[model samples]
Each structure stands twice: as structure tokens, then as C-alpha cells.
Target: MAAIQWTDVAQRLKWEATPEGYDRIRTVWLKHCDTELRQDMEGLLSTLTDDCVYTVLRTTATGATRQRWDGQEGARAFYTALFQAFPDQNWQPEAVVMGPQGVFSAVVLNARQVAPWAGIAPTGQTVSIRMFVYFIWAPDKGKFGGEVVYIAPIAE
Candidate 1:
């Protein structure tokens, strides 16, 4: 493993130094994104390691909300809740970076509130939000070991 240079900025990942490294990261990232887009839970689960950790952080004008999910069962519950809240969701990647540690993506999410989200009742309104997601790669398992998400609604 090469020395990884990490930064707190969203554009931190930088694994373009080698073809094999780039391909490896890109493949896992694309598959993860594709599965999420398709709402294919099983497919997404396949890309994760058994002890994967998933977290979500949402910040609003009022305050911030954070949640975590551990392992396979937790991941399933997290996705289920997300789909229930935003039945129609789409992710448009604004930027993506690949590094020795993981893949980082900044995305714009367009979604419809069809059900309650974080205790807020459904208003059947369309919303656009900015989200930063990181998928940590586990070389030994050749899969993603963890994922972290940060989201904030885009003010109109």
C-alpha cells in the first residue's frame, strides 16, 4: 500500500498515480453508485464487507442530525428507511475522487418526499440536496468497509 495523503476537503481522494489503483477504486465506486441509483439493496450489500459501517449526517438551518448503522443488518435498515422516505430519488455526482483509502463523491440529490423523513411528515414536495459520501476500501477483503454520508438541503 502506498502512502495515502488525506485531507478533510471533499476532493481529497487522489489515486490517479497508477492505472491498477484507479481501476480498482473506480470499479467499486461505480457499482456502489449504480446499485444505489437502481435501489438495488442486495446489489449494494454485495459491495460492502460484513462489518460495514454506514453513517449519515444532515445539517439544516435549525441544527444537525447524525445517525449510524453498523454491519449488514444495520445497512439494510438504513437503506429501507431512506427508500421509504424518498421513494423517488436520484443522485447526480458533482465530483468524485479516488485515493488509496477510499472513494469520495459530492452529489446533488433530487428526491420526492413520499413518506415521513426524520419525523417530518410527507408533503409530496420535490427537494434538492447536496450530499458528500465516502466509501472506505478494505484491501484485504477487496470491498468497501465503511461509508459516511453528509447531506444538506439546497436552499431555493
Candidate 2:
């Protein structure tokens, strides 16, 4: 994969360098992104730990709620459904802060709603969603522990 040109905010902040483990984490993360862009599930899963978990956080009229998928099987299922639903899904990173312990990023997600998502019927509309994603880094294992994502849909 080629180098990614992140958003202006990232360039201004000099995200290319800083955190002690930036290079290592960035390399792995880019690989994860590449695999996802190519819709390669096996390659994507290789970037994560065997027991990695994925959590999606949402806010509603009532309150805040979360949906979590545990273990490798769960990760597989979640990503499989996502890839199937949005075949052209892509991520445009706005900012990324890397640390020895973890990485946090703000991104704009672009996808077409070709299939139901979270029970919502497909509209076949291209949508851009702003999201904050946090990756738990297991330095000792040199792999990500899990991911926590906060989703915020961008109003058109």
C-alpha cells in the first residue's frame, strides 16, 4: 500500500511523528485499512489479536447504548456483515493520535446502504458518517486488544 495523505488537521498536527510506537502501530493500522478496502477478511483479521473485541457506541433520544462483539468469531461476523452491506465502504481519516499504549482517530466513513444496517432498511444512499475510533494496543503482544468506536452520522 502507498502512503496515505490524511486530512489537513493531521498534517498540521504533524501526526507523521510523535508517539514512541507510532511507526509500528501505524504500519499495522494501515495494513488493516488496506485489507478492509480490498474486502479481505483474512488479511484484516490478521491485524487483530485472537480474542479481539469490537464495540460500537451510540447515542439515542433515550440515552446512550453500546453493541459489542466478542472474540474472533464475533469480529468475523461483525466485519463480514459490514462488508456485505457496504461493498464500497471507505474511510477518510481526519486525525490520528498514536501512543505507546493505544491509538485514537477521527474519520469520515463513506458507504452506500445496499443492505440493512442495524435493522435499518437499505436506502441505497451514499452516506458519510463521522466517527471516533480507539484501538487498545497490547504492546507486549504487539497486537491490538480491541476496538471501541463512537459513531456519529453526518447530516447532509
Candidate 3:
């Protein structure tokens, strides 16, 4: 697969932040993931601001794909589809950092393809992929203002 065009994405998002801010936000992010794993939508939604934006960017040698969610409802729909696609989905954070632009997290997603995903039929095969997630903090709201996820398949 071709290398991910991270520079391009960064340009569009203008990612940056402070270390202290990143550390604090990382804690909230972990809680958010935990809530998601527990399938507690209300708790997960509590971690984000009302106007939060969630974006997913998937790129490969063939092409690139992008999806965006606008607010609480959008986030609900996004997570709903995700759980439907991988009912037993597990997210593991490999690394996390806060830069001047945003909080960046490297996570591994492990699950079985028991349901169709991105239009592909279920294979019942276990799959693992690495995702880079960037989050913008909302100090006033004490939650995240936005999140951008970059997903790529793990090399065999």
C-alpha cells in the first residue's frame, strides 16, 4: 500500500496543542473508549461537546475514503454503524501524544468480520487495523471538540 498522506490531512485540520493539555485530554479519551466498549452511548456522548465533529479518513494504494459526523446524533450513528460492522470490536491504544496542534493516538482495532463493513461482505475472519486519531480539546465544555481518525490495514 502507498504511504498515508498525513501531511495533506494535517494541512486541512491545522493540528496543534500543548503537552499538558494533551495529557489531560488523553485521560478523557481513554474514558470515552472505555464507555464505547461498554456500549454505553450516553456515557460516551458525555465525553464530547454538543457540537463535536468526528471524521474518518481511510487511505490505501487504490484510493482514499472520508466520512464525517456533525454532532451528538452523528456520533451515535457512526458508532452504531461501527458496532454493527464489528460486534466484538476491541480498541487498544498503542501510543498517544499531544502536539501543538492536537492530541494524536495510535490505536489497534481487533475484531471479527461478522457483519458487512464498508459494503464488503462478512468473511468471519479476524481482522486488525491501526488507526491514528487526532482530537481537538474543548476546555470550556471539558470535552473534545472534534476527532479525526485515520485508518489503515495492518501489514501481514
> All candidates' TM-scores?
0.82, 0.80, 0.78
Candidates in order have lDDT scores of 0.77, 0.74, 0.76
- lDDT tens string, model 2, 1-156? 111135633543543344556778888888887887898989888888887888888665667767788877887888888887888887899998877656799999788978865444578998776889887665656677678888776665
Who wins the lDDT comparison? Answer: 1
- How displaced is residue 112 in candidate 1, in Å? 0.9
Model 3, 9-113: lDDT tens per residue? 566356455566667677788788789898888989888888888888888888888778888898888778878878888788899876544467898988887
Give candidate 2's whole-model lDDT.
0.74
| lDDT (10s digit) by residue, model 1, range 25-84 | 788878987898789999989888898888877777888887788898988888898788
What residue runs in model 1 are displaced by over 4 Å at the alpha carbon? 1-17, 118-121
Model 3 ranges with Cα > 4 A deviation:
1-24, 99-102, 118-121
Candidate 3, residue 69: lDDT: 82
Model 3 CA RMSD to the hidden true structure, in angstroms: 5.1
